[model samples]
Structure formats: C-alpha cells, structure tokens
Target: MIEADDNENVERLRRIEAVTDAALSRLDTEDLLDELLDRVRDLMRVDTAAIMLLDPHSQHLVATAAKGLEEEIRRNLRIPVGSGFAGRVARTGQPVVIENVGENDVVSPVLRDTGIRSLLGVPMLAGPDLVGVLHVGTLQPRHFTPDDVQLLQLVADRAGLASQARLTMIDRTAALALQRSLLPTRLPEVPGVDLAARYVPGHEAGIGGDWYDVFTLPSGWLGMVVGDVSGHGLQAAVVMGRLRSALRAYALECDNPADALTRLDRKIQHFETGNLATVLYAMISPDREWIRVSLAGHLPPVTASPGCPAELMSLPVDPPLGIGAVQVRHSTVVAFPPDAVLVGYTDGLVERRGELIDIGLDRLRAATQPDDAETVCAVIMTALAPERPADDIALVGIRRQTPAG
Candidate 1:
C-alpha cells in the first residue's frame, strides 16, 4: 500500500508538470493563467485555484484568473502586500500553507465565506522579481505536504516567464497601432498622376519612425514627402508625427521645397532638441512637366523615363532637421517628361547589415519600373522586401499617366 501511494503521488506530479508546460506555451496571458488555474485545481484535487498578478503601478495583487470560485468574488478581489494569504506569499517571495483558513486572521471574510478551510499559496518568481501569486484551496481542513508546495512553486515560475513575455507583446502591439494611426491612411488623388505608397514594419521591433505623405498644395501642385526619424518605438513615432504635421503646414505656405524644409528645420531645432530626422520633399507642377526636389540629409529621389532605366538624381544635400538654425538648404528642379515615374523611400528599403548603401541602391535601380504607380510600388516591395525586414520601410511613388489619344 505504501509503494502504491508513492506511485500515485509521482503520477500526479508528472501530470501537473505536463499541464504547466502547456500553460506556458499559450500566447495570451489571461488564457494561460486560466488554464493554469483549472489544471491546478484538478491535479491537486482542490476545490478552488486562483492566480493573482501584481499591478506594477498600484502595487496591489489583483485576481487575474480563477477556477471554482464565485464570479463576484474573483472580479472584486484585490489583495494588498503583506495582507491576505496570497499577499503574504507575494510580499515574502515564499510559499505559505494554511491548515485552516477559518482560524487564520489573515484570511479575508469573502474567502472564508466560500468554505475554504485549508489553502496553499506560492509566489511566482521571475529571476529576482516577484511577479505574482498562485494559490489553491480546499473545503475541508487538510495539510499541504512539501511535495505539493514544490510542485506549485515550479508551476508559478513557469507562469511568471509566460506572463512577462505576454506583457511585452501587448506593449509592442499598442505601439504599432499608434504608429499606424499617425500615418496617412490613403494618398490623395492628383490629376494626371498615379500614386502608390507602402509602409512595412520591421519584424523584431514591430514599428519605427518611417513615414510618407502625399497631398495637393494650394497652387495645384502635388506635394510628396518621405522621412526617417532616428531610433525606433513609441518616442520616435511621436516625433515623426510632430515633424510631419509641421512640414505640411510649412509646405502649404511656401512654394519652394527648400524654403519649406528650412522652416521645418528651424521648428524642430527650437522645439525638439536632440531629435534628428532625414527628409526629402518634392513639389510637382500642375502640368506634370517639372518637379522641384529638396533634400535634408536624405537619400536622393529616383526617376524612370519611358524606355530608360531608373536613375538616382543628383541633388545637393543639407543637414537633417533639428541640427541647428544655421544649415543652408537648396532645391533642384528636374524635367518630368511624359510617362515618367518618380520614387522616394526611407533607408530601410535599400539598407542591409554589413553591406554598402550603394549595393542596395543598385538593386533598387534594377527593379522593374512599370508605368502604373501601383505596379511599380508592388514590384519594388517584392524585389527589396520579400521577407520580414530588419528595419521599417516607407516608399512613395508617382507615375505621370500617358495622355489618352
């Protein structure tokens, strides 16, 4: 009988470990906690199981997931540090076993009312930090053995790691959404011009400060801008939005691309200190015969005429925005013949680790330059970014439509 009992205990622990592994594999934090609680309750033959996660800002343990507990109790429960059973375990970063909760003053009235006579609580530790608490309760008075405590602690460790990853993913997802919201949802339609744009986020970082915009100016000229702010994540995205708005306002007031960029540079220098961004702005005339381009420490724009290969235009480059008020900027005018295509893009399109920028530029020039704006955009993206790129990419292309006979 002794041997049989020992075998049974070992099998129960094996099952618990298996379920813990499954829970850790879940992507959603809440779902993983819920599954963990359910598995704990069943594997330990306990009446109830729950997981309480610490709110970093509030420093309170909130019940995130639970099994076999009243919905009202689970939703309304908040345990402060060093207070209740779970709180004490979280505060001390150790396991606590109660043979009889009714006799313990630390047990909350709500928990006592649920007929939980005995309980076991363990801290979920991720390295040196205490992430949360995991607890199980029984209706009848029962003693929790050392083996039970050890098994629960192991499960808690796994849960803590999974929770941390889930939180990081949630933060990235929110940042990406904000970045997308700030970008232009659709390009404005310009007469005699076909427009196409693409924004591709990096695989690892998820979002960065790459932006593109196309709009019609007051003088019936089509205005286009492509820019890249230094750095990645939410802060860079906020700076990009501010710069984009300021450039649009300046572009509307000034006819020359260089003048608008100069004003934008001054605005950035005065307001956003230490923030630098490279930008290329172009203004296309209403007749679609000429385009004025200006560069602020950015890559030169590319032009492709009918029956000719795509070539990068040579233009004088100035300092990027937010440098200072002294840097001089200038504009270069180029003839845009019929059935010509002009493209502006961020560095992500032509940048690779451990390679020269000229190599990427050569690849970009070799890409198929179709007459249709959308086709050219698709072809460039396919040729340059076939997989998850290491950096964010922003591309804007304008093709002059051939006049109908």
Candidate 2:
C-alpha cells in the first residue's frame, strides 16, 4: 500500500516536468503563459492560475493571461509593483507561499472574494532583473510547501525568457510591416524615371535594414532614396523606420535635398546605434533642365545619356552616418539634357560574388543605354539574371523627357 503523501509528491513532480516542457516548447510568451497557467492549476491542485507581466513602463504588472479567474476580475486587475503579494514578489524578487491566506496581510481582498484560502507567488526573473510573477491559489486551506514555491519559480524563469523572445519578435514584425507599407506601393509614373526597386530581407529570419523610397517632392521634383544600415536584423530595422519617416517629414519641410538628409541625420542622433548607414538622395524635375544629387558613403550613381557614355557621379561626402560627426555639402546640380537616364543603387548590387564590383558596375552601366526609363530597368535586371542576389538591392532610374516640337 502506498502512502497518500508520497503518491501526491510524485504526481506534483510529474506536473512540474510537464509545465516546464510546455513552456520551453513555445518561443512566444503569450502561448507559453497560456500553457503554463493551465499546467500550474493541475500541478498545485489549485482552482485558478494566472501570469502577470511587467509593462514596458515598469509601473504596474498587468494580467497578461489567466486560466480560471472570472472574465471581469481578470480583465480589470492590475497589481501595482508593491500593492499585493504578487507585487511584493515582483518588487523584491522573492518567492512567497502562504499556507493560510486568511491570516496573511498581503493577500488581496479581491482573491478572498474568489474563495481562495491558500496562495503561492514567485517572481519571474531574467538574470537579476525581475520581469513579473506567476501564481496559483487554492480554495481549500492547504499547507503549501517549499518545493511548491521552488517549482513555480523554475516555471517563472522560463516564462521570463519566453516573454522577452516574444516581445522582440513582435517589435520586429511591426517595424517590418510598417516599413513595407510606407514604401511606394507602385513606382510613380514620371516622365523620364525608369525605376526598378527590390527590397530583400537579411539572411536572418526577421526584417532587413535595407529600404528604398521614391515619391514626388513639393516642387514637382521626383525624389529617390536608397539606404543600408551597417548591421542586419531587428535593431537595424528600427533605425531604418525612424530614418525613413524623418526623411519624408524633412523633405516636405525643407527646400534642398542636402538639407533634408542633414536634418534627418541630426534627428536620428537622439537614439545611438553602432550601425552606420549609407544613403544616396536625389531630386529630378520634369523640365529636363537640371538634376540635384547627393551621396553619403553610398555607391556613386551612374548617369548615362545618348552620346554621353555612362559616367559615375563621384562627389566626395562624409562617411556613413554613425561613423562619426558628419557635415554635408550643398548638392551638386548637373545640367540634364532631354532623354537622359540616371541609375542609383545600393552597394549590394555591385558586391555580388563571381564578379568584381567594377565588373558589375560596368555591366549595369552597359545596360543603361538609349532606352526609356522602364526598358532601362528591365535590361539591368536581365543583365543580373538568375536573381541569386545575396545582399539587398535597390535601383532607381530617372530619364528626362524630350520637349515636343
């Protein structure tokens, strides 16, 4: 005959393993917590279980998920960092087990209404920082054990890791979706601009730092920008979003192309990143009389017109933003004749393997000859055929329309 206590102990250990395994299986926090709270009720022999997560502001712990609490209480409850038992556990990074909650001062009066007599709470900590708390409360006046607190704490630690991972995934997904939406849905129909643009996410699973935007400026000038931050993945995507939004705002507010970029760089300095970004900004007007171009550590743009063999615009500018302090010069305005074409691209287009960068540039320049803007884009994409692009590529081609006789 087996003792009741021994059998219960074995069952509790089995439930602990199950909860930990379930939490580890999920990379997302919300899913992990859902599984965790369900398993906690089973493991602790409790009526209900809940998981609270620290808000970004860190002022209060919100009930992110619950297994058995009423919809009304669960929806409305937010425990301040030092208000209840769970709050104390979060603030002090300690585990608390109340054998008799009716005698305890920290147990929330709200839980009393739920008829809970015994409660256990554990801080969910990542390293030394506390993330939130996990708790289970029972209706019967039960004797909670040290092993019970330890088991919940182990689960809480796993919950912290899951939460942080999910938070990062959410942030990257939001920024990438917003970035894609902000980019031109379809290339604008400009008289002389042949634009072929492609945005490739980095080798990693999340969003890439590369982006391009083409739109009409206030003064009937066509604007184009292609840029790449130094690193790949989420951090870069965040900075890219900010830079892209600021550029659009500045372009509307400023008069000159260089001034827009200069203001953009200054606005972004508030948030520091080791990653540097290379940008090429240009404005083209319909009159076919002039083109304003500027470069900041980006590949020099190629301009080719009939009778004028392709030439690279190699104006010197400061290194990419975040390399160090930078000062931008006035944009160089070139005399554009009728039916001229200009192609602008990121370094990735030129840095493909199996051929030198110069070879790629020559190939691209060769494809830019006596064609309309759309045909020019198709020709270059064909030249770089098979589409095995390792790095992100963005290209914009602008051509000036010939005036009617």
Query: Which candidate number would show the highest lDDT if scored against the true structure?
Result: 1
TM-score computed on alpha carbons, candidate 2: 0.70
Q: Residue-wise lDDT of candidate 1 within 133-237, one digit each (tens)?
A: 888889898899887897788778878888766766765777688779878888887788999999999986567788999999879999999999888876788
Off by over 4 Å in 1: 1-28, 34-156, 175-185, 232-239, 262-276, 307-309, 322-326, 368-370, 401-405
Return the TM-score for each candidate structure: 0.66, 0.70
Per-residue CA lDDT of model 2 for 1-405, tens digit only, reads 469889987887786788767435744566677777777777777887878888755578877777766552455677789877788878788887777775454545556667777778888877777777888888887787877887888888888877866776777788678667766788877665455565555443355667788888767787888887766555677778778887888888866778887776666565654667888888776565877877777888888878988878767665666665675545878877777777877766667666678987787777777567778767776776335566656677777766551
For candidate 1, list the clashing residue pairs, or say none: none
Kindly give the stretch of ten consecutive residues in candidate 2 with the minimal lDDT sum.
Answer: 198-207
Q: Which ten residues in a row have the lowest lDDT in candidate 1?
A: 102-111
Task: Kindly report which residue pairs in candidate 2 clash with one another.
Answer: 192-399, 194-373, 194-397
Cα error, residue 40 of model 2, in Å, equals 1.5
Clashes of 2: 3
